[model samples]
Target: MDNMFRLMGSEEFSDRRRCIWVNGPVIIGAGPSGLATAACLHEQGVPFVVLERADCIASLWQRRTYDRIKLHLPKNVCQLPKMPFPENYPEYPTKRQFIDYLESYANRFDISPQFNECVQSARYDEVSGLWRIKTTTTSSIAGSEMEYICRWLVVATGENAERVVPEIDGLTTKFEGEVIHSCEYKSGEKYRGKSVLVVGCGNSGMEVSLDLANHNANPSMVVRSSVHVLPREIFGKATFEISMMLMKWLPLWLVDKLLLILAWLILGNLTKYGVKRPNMGPMELKVVTGKTPVLDIGAIEKIKSGDVDVVPGIKRFYRNHVEFVDGQRLNLDAVVLATGYRSNVPSWLQENDLFSKNGFPKSAFPNAWKGKSGLYAAGFTRKGLAGASADAVDIAQDIGNVWREDSKIHKMRSRVVYRRCISLA
Candidate 1:
């Protein structure tokens, strides 16, 4: 891998082709997908330099996520290639453990990405067959705007780039107390002993509420809808094992019903605490179809124990008071919104009409853009917590296959790219 990077890095680049350093392929986002893709590319003799927007690797882990977060997937299945967590680590690593694992992975793979440099825009130059990438950051030794011209561009930026704060009516104008997005959440110490409202029941929501409960914060979870909340460890085995064993054969509807029934039998209505299990089927197919298991986080248990209060969705907020859809109102100290995130592709591409109708850059696999430019996207979709690991495997496999094919045709093509410029401008 080192030999490959050295070889590619030494290649002579055109000075006229100013964009990237013209070292090798350019990768955006130094999160899990970026690191994994870099590892595979290194092993396969592909040279790439990763551009990160944060001050360190795994910024999401170190910055965005809350304390006490744990991987829902078991450690074994979620392990990365060529790098595994130490045996002494927990079966399901905590947020800190995960950060250590990623840091170790980056070190082992020799992925010294330039930190604090955020990519602003990237465009493919058809005439030069190079990708022109621009950035806004102080880290670049070359000064303000750095450029890179490369044959390929790989976007390893995962889906969790931008937090999805909902545009609630009167939220900005009326609300008073501390209102923060999930991405800004660091700990629950501030909410301790205070009435807190946590919106969203996804893994983040569950974990946050539990943390607040553990801290005796008296937090209340606002569940807007129904979701399948499964035990992380079921019957001394990972719930994914059960899901794989049972969910595959049974129809989705049946599986949803069965899981709900089982949860009800074990956990009860959950409504008294304010959580309502859907009567029909799973709200999202992503949960029902995939074997990704949701952690219960004992939020229901917290509610049952009266540590955490479960409440309906927020109807409105006035000063330090909150109104719910149930026509109930309460005064709260803080509101932590666990609302999800949107995939933020760099600006250059966004302005060029590159994304699909769904906002994802159009590509089938590892490659995000299915054009002759060889631009690919590594991870722009959220599969789960283990999504980083899962996506790494798939992207590595695809990049390997694509690189092999490109290598074979490398010598057959003309050295210079001559493209007739068409005026779309």
Candidate 2:
């Protein structure tokens, strides 16, 4: 790799093009997917550099999530390749605990990432068969710039890079109350004794409403569309674990049917609690559309008990109240938009063909890790951490194969050149 770059003469390469060369792959984002990819590459004896925009690893888990957040999936399923959560951890670890676990995992493997370095842009140089990456470090006041060239580029930035706050009519100027997205929400202490309207009914929306209710806030949720709400546990075990076990033996249709029946028996009729259930089953929805089902913790109980009220989607916002689509209005002190996020992969990705019309990876699971023009996407899987780990393994294997083949070809070409030179001498 060094020799290939050295072969470029001064006439062909300018001083600006002589960037810091990284012989191996360059992994972006130091979250779960990035770290997992690094670990896999290390195991294959492949040297790589990890670049993190934040000051620490797992910035999403460390900063973006709310204080009371916890992993919806069980610890076993969420564990990385060889590192498992502490034995003493709860079935579902809290956000802080999960962040600690990530930190420990990175430290245990000696996976040191370049922190505070945000990737500004990456362009593939066809002539050199490498990726030219421009980055800006956040540590300095002037934002020092740096460049690097690598053979392969791995984009491990997860799905939730940018917050998606739905636009509401009259929300900007008419509403005088506080407005926030779920990403900015920490706790409900500031909302105490206030009538808060939480938009969207996903997992975060449900949990945040419950947190507000518990903290003395009169909370109401906006059920914009149909959603599948499931109990966190069934009988004596986690519902996710039960579903996984059933999936192993039963077909998808039958598994969905059984899970639906179980959910109906445990949670009773969601319609009775003003929560509208989608026509599709939870498992089916996840498999078909990749939409996450809201895993109920204590939110359903609160809703049924009249602590958290349910309302239709918002029509518009008023000076001191919000008008619902059903022609009803409620006086609210604040509005929390738990509308979720969109993938920011297109922001810095020069190759537009690598993304779909919706800006998501064009490829599906198992194949999503590989993209066009020597690009790879990680952590975009529907199965979350488990899917990401699997994708990392596939990516590492593919990269290793390509690298080996390229090395062999380069060696053959070098031998041919040497023989020709000896004959000329």
Assess the local accuracy of residue 307 in candidate 2 as a C-alpha lDDT between 0 and 100.
92
Supply every candidate's count of residue pairs whose N, Cα or C atoms clash at under 3 angstroms: 9, 0
lDDT per prediction?
A: 0.71, 0.86
Total clashes, candidate 1?
Answer: 9
TM-score each candidate: 0.83, 0.92
Candidate 2 residue lDDT tens string, 21-115: 78789999999999988888877777889999999899888878899999999999898876888999998999989988998988877799999
lDDT of 2 at 49: 91
In candidate 1, what residue range of length 10 has the lowest lDDT sum? 416-425
Residue 120 CA error for candidate 2 (Å)? 2.3
Best by lDDT: 2
